[model samples]
Each structure stands twice: as structure tokens, then as C-alpha cells.
Target: MLNTNETRIKYFFILGFPGILPEYYGPVSALLFLFYLAITMGNIFVLVFVKCERSLQKQTYYIFCHLALTDLLFGTVTLPKAISKYWFNDSIISFYSCLVQMFFVHLIGAAHSFILMVMALDRCIAICIPLRYNSLFSNKTVSVLCGISWLVPTMFMVAIMYEILRVPFCNSNIIVQCYCDHMSISNLGCDHVREVKIVALVLAMISLLLPLGFIILSFFVIIAVVLRISSIRGCIKTLSTCTPQLIITCLYYLPRCFYYLANFVGYSFSVPVQIVIVMLYSHIPAAVNPLIYCMQTKDIKEKLKKKLFSWKIDSTTKPMQDKTWQ
Candidate 1:
């Protein structure tokens, strides 16, 4: 319980979720551990698939690769500690460590937003204006966009972190969410937090809303182009390509929308409910994004099927080979 009056705050005790019965902690911990496991394995599959299969190395998948990487990074940064908090009751984090965690949590989130926006643009180019897809989305161009996705968020979050660092936290050290975040950390600071709030609002706009707006605009144009295609097959094909992106977008954005709007509208949710919603949006994408791509994308699915079939063949033939050798 370091006070602001003292030299400086030393640590933060992260209260993973504010409310749960003693009986529920084990179940909750088990569930979150499972979530972390799923997220890790799913994202790894996508990453390995992208790396191993040359056919999956298209510009669009370059964006998907970044998205998968971001999700993996996001989950890795934010989840294990939270899982530890729930399972082992190791909730204390040093102040600076908390800051670092906050940085990556937001950094990766903003990067994911930008990546999704880039994917929308790729989808639009591929589906709406097929001729220019090659010209507009070359590997070099996608690489540049990927760099921007990482760089812009880093810049924005750095600014936000600077502002956060300036806030004096002399109050109680419990963060109400499952992890340390900008809002939770800043709220614990002593003094007027108007500046932090302003910065957060701006960051949210730049990182979340701006990308979402661009995605919406892209979707509208894509729908218009898709409508013009006379053949049902062409329309279905175009729509199918866009569907996974849309699903991923919705998972990432919709919960954020509800949370942000609830706060803005002064709607009060129970702490447990809020925590549940926040945790779902924060980590579920890590699991869902890769699963969606693996199942929905034709190329990735084909590659995965071939790999699985090869594994099955190897497993069945391994015993026969051993017997023959004997």
C-alpha cells in the first residue's frame, strides 16, 4: 500500500476479477487456463501454417500473419499473469512491471485494430476491384502496411504511457479488471485524472474508432461491388472471402463498443459482469481468429487437411515399417 505522499508507488496488487465466490475460483482458474491454452495453440497453428505453406503467403495472409502474431502477443502478455492471479493467488505486480504490461496490452490491441483495417482494405481491393489487387497489394506494400500497423500503435501508446507515468498513484493498488490496463491503472492515481481521461479518449478514437470507421466504409463499398456481380457464384465467393474478416472484426469490436458505450452512457454493470465481458473481448480473439481462418480460408484448410492426412498416413505406416524392419 504505497502512498502517493511517500516517494513513489512501488507495486500493484492485480485483483484479477473483483467478485467470485471461494468455490468458484478453481473453476474460474481452470476455465481461463483452458482459454490461454486454446489461444496459444490456435495462433501457433496459424503462424506455422503461414510460415510453412508457400501458397498461403499471399499479401492478404501477410495481414493475417500479423493479426495472428498480435493476438498471440496480446494473449501471452496479458493472460498468464491473470491465470496465475486466479490460480495461485499471485496478484502482486511491481509498479514498473505493471506499466510494461499495460503498454503491451494496449500496443498489441491497437496493432490488431490496424491489422484488421488493413485486411479490410485488402478484402476491398480483392473483391471490389480485382484488377488493381496485384498493383495495390504487392508484398512490399503489405510489408509497409504491417510496419505502419506496428509503428503507429507504438507511437500512440507511448504517448499514452507517458501521460500515465506522469499520473501520481497514491491510492489503493487494486486493479479491478483481470489485468492491468490504462483505465484501471490511471483510475488508481491520485489527483485530477482529467488529462489521463482526455488522452485515453483520443487514444481510443485513433486506435479503435478510426480503424472501425475505415472498415465500415470498406464494407459498404464491397457490398456495392458484390451486388453488381450477376452470377450467384461470384457473389458467394466474394462474400465468403469477406465473411471471416467480418466475424473477426465483430468479435474484436463489438465488445469494445458495448464497454465504451456503457461507460459513456453512464450505464452501470456489475463488476463481475464487466470483468467477464472485458476478459472475453480481450482474449477470445486469440482463439477465435485462427480458428476462423483455418476453417474458412480455402487455401489454409486445404493445406491443413493435407498435413493431417500426411500425419495419419505416417502414424498408420510407422508400425508396419517397424514390423517390416524387425
Candidate 2:
């Protein structure tokens, strides 16, 4: 039984790796880089393809474009630094660097969460009141939603930053995990993380569970509507459109749901499992989104064709064809 007087283990001792297995720094670092290369290149290609392709400039997919951008930002904020620490086993981030890292991480994370919410809302409005979907999710409305999705997360991250800055450092300054995570930074604080945690819980409810609840409700409604459609073709088309979004949402949220559940429920998963879980939380959102949007979208494909064709040159070393932006 932990004593009431025992301060909740102020300042976690980040004793170096437990070293259960051999450290393959070389292979791990290489693998991490390869993953980044794939994610970064793929996402960049998707975004540029979408933007350059004029046919893609529509409401729902426009929402998806911004979603892709935010996901890119999310991956950018966490993985590079994490990859740095993982291969190096070096935990010497300056306090200021840690603070910035912490801020951007939460910023991107909150943005990703909220953007998913926006997507659900867009789908909901489109399905629930198709008559007014154009009016409801108009250029202005979507623009506002996208702007808020980026801005609110910035504010939320600032709050977490304040909480983290209040901590009193103890013995060791090393972070045990791949990067400077939320809990790891929170652990740096001394007593009185109570208020911060409550705020955290509330923000999380807004960010994750609240949106998830809305999405679930909206999906059920969407499903009910599809069932009532007189034509099977209508039903199938609706299902097809929803499928990619559903898959991407589940992939992005399920791991995070499990990671938190594991933390709250008390489990004995090994460090490697935990590490993989964390990596999934950071990477999969970025990775799967482009794959989902691009494969499902024909307009984007055409734009890619146009852009690639104009940008490619003849083998005879002639100049490239002129490109026209739609």
C-alpha cells in the first residue's frame, strides 16, 4: 500500500534501458528511417497530387486534404525526434527543446483528433440532410472547421505546456521511451499534477471520446438510412463511400484507445509491444490516410496523371511539357 504521505513518486527515475534483449540500434534506426521515408514520401505525393489536381477541389475531399495535412504535421512533430532518441538511446533534450517538442506533439495530436471529428460531422451533415449539405458544409463552413481544427489544438497544447513547465526536476533527466511523450513530461513535474490532469481529462474527452461518440451515433444513423434506400445500388454506393473513412478512423483511433486502456487497466505487455503501440499511435494515421483517399478517389488519380505527364520529359532529353494548374 502506498502511503498517503508518499508523494506520487515525484520525478521519475529514467534509469537507462532495462536491456532485456540485445540492442540492434543499427537495424532499428534503419527500419525507423525507412518507415519515415515511406510515410513522408507517400503523404507528400498524395497532398501535392490533390492540390495540383483541379478536379480534387471539392467539399468532402477538401476536408480530407486538410486532414492529410494535419496528419502530416502530426507525424512530423513526433516521429523524427522519436526516431532520433530510439536509435541513439540518448536522452539529453534540453529543457527548452523538450518544451517545444511537448507543445508541437500535443498540438498535432489534438489536431488529428479534432479533424476526425470534423470528418464525421461532414459525413453526418451530408447524410442526415442531403438537401442542405451544400449549405451546411459550404466553402465557408468547412474553411472555419479546418481553421478551428488547427487552432484549438494549438491552445490545448499551450495548456499542457504550462502544466509541464511547473514540474520540479529530480535526479535523472533522461526519458526512457522513444521520445518525450506527454506522460513522460508530466512525470517530470513534482507534486500537484492534479489540476493539470483534470484539464487533460476534459480536453481528452473533447478530443477523443466525445468525437468518437458523435461518430458512432452518426454512423448508426448513416447505416439506418442506407438500409432504407429503395435501390440496392444506392445502398452499395453509400457503403462504398463510407468504407474508406470508416477503415481509416478505426485504424487511427483503435490503437490509441487500446494504449490508454492498457494504461488505465494495468497490464503486463512487454516494452516492445508498448513501443509498437506508441509508434502506431504516431505513424499509422499518416500512413493509411493517403492510401485510403488516393485509392478510392478517381479524380485524384486523373490529376496525378495530368501532373505526372506534364512534368515528365522525353528520353531524348527534350524539355518537359508545359503544365497547366486547374
Candidate 3:
């Protein structure tokens, strides 16, 4: 029988930066607010620009837009509460609300992993088997892959959330991390902690490693195909196309894998260091992914330059036209 009286954790108090002194809170909050703003505006611009511009309506761009959307959701779900926690000292999140946040954090993250894998696959087909790239990755096929990226993660996260909900929380309500994640929340459960942790870990590995494996394989194949090109100019052109995706992939996966491995091995860092690593893996990619694409991809860079030039012309000309009319 369950003891109703013992299960009294109605809310969780998130300790965003337990080690930082009060004087630094404002600065930290300001920095986080900037990151949130950058992530929101950057991803929104990518999504909107891709939707409005027909020239960007290709298989690779479609996957890029999906990645942008995933980054937007991930940042929106986690950053606001963290900003509130530092800015106003408001860290109390209702138990169910924490669960909801945890669910979306993992859901969007898994979706991102899968989307990146799809991007790698797209590149692989384009580079390794150039003749059939269009036929292999048509609009319908891209849509189906993107749909699976989202839908499969949704089902997995739903199951993980169900398992988390069943864990009885009768202990401390303080979450040592910035936001409520699976491991952070499950650690507070009174019982079945090991089982819940194992289940969550297994699901997390499936979401991360499976996609990572495919991405590695795809990149290896791409490299091999690129190597067979005899011309120096051909090699440079082919490798340049993949550089941005490669950078973003490294930024997203490396820190996360390091953190997980450290935790799995029972190695601990100071609170501030740990928090920095977490934020690096979580927020940096979202804030910079669009910028990387805009700067690195020739089509996106040219289109963005054109859009900016037109906007400047309109702003300058509208004032002159109004004055002349008056």
C-alpha cells in the first residue's frame, strides 16, 4: 500500500547555481537572457526564411529547418525557468510541471539527435551517390523521415515520463541542476531509484547512441567517397559543404557524451563547473546553429545578404518618399 502522507513533494526547488554568490546572480541571469534571446530569434528567423523562400525548398534545407525548430523548442522549454530562477530567485516548480519540462527536454533532444542523423544521411547520399540523390531523398521521403524523427521520440519520451511518474517522491524537493531532467528528478525518489535510473538510461542511450552510430557511419562513407575524387578542387568543394554540419554535430554531441560518461563513472565536478558543461551542451548549439548555416552555406548566405540589402534599401527609401510627399 502507498503512504499518502509520506508523498509530500508538491514542488521542486531548482538550484541553478548553488556555488555562485548573490552578487553574480544578476550577471549570470543577464547572460542567460541573452542566450535565450539569441536562440529564439535565430531559430525563428531560420524557420521563417525557409518557409518564405522557395529556393530553399530542398531535402537538406528541410532537415535544417526541422533542426532549427527542435532547437527553438529545447531552449524555450528550459531557459525561461532558469532565467527566472536566477533573476527573481523564483525556482519553485510544481511537481507535475517539472515532469512536463523533463518530458519535453528529452523529447526535443531526441528529435534533434534523429534530425542530425537524417542530415548526415542526406549528405551521404548527395556526396557518395550523387546520381540518385534526388530520387533517393524526395520531398515525401524527407517528410516521412522528419515525421519519424518526431513521432518515435514522442512515444519513447511518453513511456519514460510514465515510468518517472510512477516513482514515489517522498524525499527532498531540491533539484541540484538548472532544470528538471530525468536523472536529477529520479534521484529524489524514495524507492525504485535504481530501476528507474536504469530504464531512463537505457532509453536515453537508445535515443542518443543509435542515431550517433548512423551519423558516424554516414560520415565515414562520405569521407571515403570524397577521397576517391582525384581533383584538389573537387575535394575542397565537397568537404566544404559538410563543414558546418560537422561543426554543429561536434558541438552538440561531444559535451553531452562527456557529461554522461562522467556521471556514469561516478565522477563529480564542482557545481559551477558541472552547470557550465550542462549549459554548453544544451544552449550553445541552439544559439549558434542558425548562424553557422547562414555563414557557411552558399545559398543561405547569398539569400540572407540579399534580404538584408533589400531591407536596408526599403528603410532608407521609405523615409525619403514620405518627406517628399509631405
Candidate 4:
């Protein structure tokens, strides 16, 4: 219903936390900044520790490294802008920049889902068919799987972005979300809005549901395999290895599934509540994944302990050496 003379919007305003009071912005931004720091440092440590330690170079660790990289990229893409928006009251983003952010958000998110599916598959094969685990998931195979994770999502999102580009934006330029994404940006378009929404919803459902389904199925198989073990100690030991992945998988997928399902059913929450849910699912998993891995994975835990002990030793000895020199 918009006239052709209505000026095309050049930039968009992100109205993050729609009902939040001005006084609370600093505290919220500080919390977000802390999450950004945790995500950055933890994932970086995982990547570096895995890379430098030759003993950690294996199929499972390779998948973990890929996950760390994906999580780091996810936090980098989404968090800083939200942080700046709150800290500086800078919510304006140029149209193209928003599109670029949307593209990367979907791309990386899809890649992450696929990567998780790969992780589930990896665990499934390791547990179900231990004899051929290495042969099944070789270095080349992992590289191909990870490459496909990134590549397929890139191609899919590029197509979506192309469709998004064709839509004209001449109406409201305010996005009621912390960041730009397919839904938030597409909703601003004045033409083909419903069609775009339908297409986006369908694609999102496919992208999210497919991997989620696979993960669920994989876990079921893993549980069955674990239950079949005759000895209680062996079963407990096997289940412990899977516990971290299960925790992270639930953290990453469950909230997102709920949000998407709610959207599909046309049930809506308050704007602030919706944004909070999105942030909880998107940010918390990345921030917590490294901690879960470090605390649960025996190899990483031992290495971290050793590294910290060495640092502690150096810290105490350095002051003693300085006093002796004096």
C-alpha cells in the first residue's frame, strides 16, 4: 500500500530491548560485554590448545575445533554490535550492512547446525561401530564434512539474500531486535512481505529441523547402545563421554526450536521477552560451550590444569628471582 514516491530507507534503527529503561542500558551492555569476552577467550583457548597439542589431534577434537571457530565467528558477528548499541546508543545500521549481517547470521547459524549434526554423527559412529570409527571419520572426511557445513550454508544464504535484495523497503525502518536477521529485516520490506516470510520460514524450518532431527536420532541410538552395555561401570563410563555434547546440544537447539515453533504457530510474546529469548539461546551456548568442554573432557581438563599450574609456578618464582637479583 506504500506509494512509489515514499523514499527508500537507507538505514535501519535497531530498537533493542524495546521497553528497557535508559538507566539499565549500562548494566545490560556490561553483561553482554562480559559474555562476548567469555566467548572470545574460551573458544580461542580451545582452538589454540587443540592445535598446539599433538595428542589432541583426532577426529573428535577436529570437530571441536571447528565448533570453537564457528562459535567465535557467531559471537563476533552478533555481540559487538549489540554491545555498541547499548553502550553508545548507536542503533543505526546502513541497509547493506544490515543485509550483510543477516547473511552472515543465517550462514553461520546454518553452518553451526550442520556442524552439530556432524558431531552427533561422529559420536554415533564412534559408539555404535567402534571398530571402524577411525576409518569412517578420517581427517579428509572431517575436512569434507566441515567444508560442506560452511559451503552449503553459504550457497543457501546467498540465494536467500538474493531474494531479499529484490524486495523493496519503503516503510518503517525500525527493527525490534538486538540484531539483523532474515525475519527482522525481511519484515521491514514493503513488497512481497508475506511471500518472503513464508519462504524464509520454510527454509529456516528445513535448515534447523533437519539437523535437529538427525541429532535427536543420533542420541537415541547412542542411548540404546549405552544401555546395552552389560557392566554398569562400562555404561557409566560411556555415558560420561557423551554428557558434555548432550548438554551443549540441548543448550543450543531447544530454545531455538521453541522460538521457531512459537513463531510458526503465530504465538507472540512481548517484544522484550522475545529478544531476551533470542539472546539467551544465541549467546549463552557460545559462552558456555567452552566451559562445558573444558570441565567435562578429560584431555582438555588435564591440559588446562597443567598449564595453570605452570603459570602459577612461574608467577611465584618470578618474584623470588627478582628479590634475589636485587
Q: Give the best candidate by TM-score.
A: 1
Error at 42, model 2, angstroms = 1.6
TM-score of each: 0.94, 0.83, 0.93, 0.92
Better TM-score candidate (2, 3): 3
| Model 3, runs deviating above 4 Å | 1-5, 262-267, 312-326
After best superposition, candidate 4 residue 322: deviation in angstroms?
7.6
lDDT value, residue 281 of candidate 4: 89
Give a tens-digit lDDT track for model 2, residues 198-268: 77777766877877887898899988988999999989987777766787788878888877887789875
Model 4, total clashes: 0
Per-residue lDDT of candidate 3, residues 202-303 (tens digit): 888898999999999999898898999999999999999998889889989999888878988999888788877888789999999999989988899999
Instruction: Estimate the Cα RMSD of every predicted model relative to the unseen true structure.
Output: 1.8, 5.7, 2.9, 2.5
Worst window of 10 by summed lDDT in candidate 3: 1-10
Q: Which of the predicted structures, 2 or 4, would earn the higher TM-score when compared with the native? A: 4
For model 1, how does the per-residue alpha-carbon lDDT over 178-230 read when each residue is reduced to its tens digit? Answer: 88898898888786578888988788788888999999999999999889999
Badly placed stretches (over 4 Å) of model 1 are 2-7, 318-326
TM-score ranking from best candidate downward: 1, 3, 4, 2
Give the C-alpha miss distance for residue 77 in model 3, angstroms: 0.4
Candidate 4's residue-wise lDDT over 79-181, tens digit each?
9899999999999988889999999988888998898899999989999999999999987899899999999888888778878888888778888899999
Sort by lDDT, best first: what order? 3, 4, 1, 2
Indicate the TM-score of model 1. Answer: 0.94
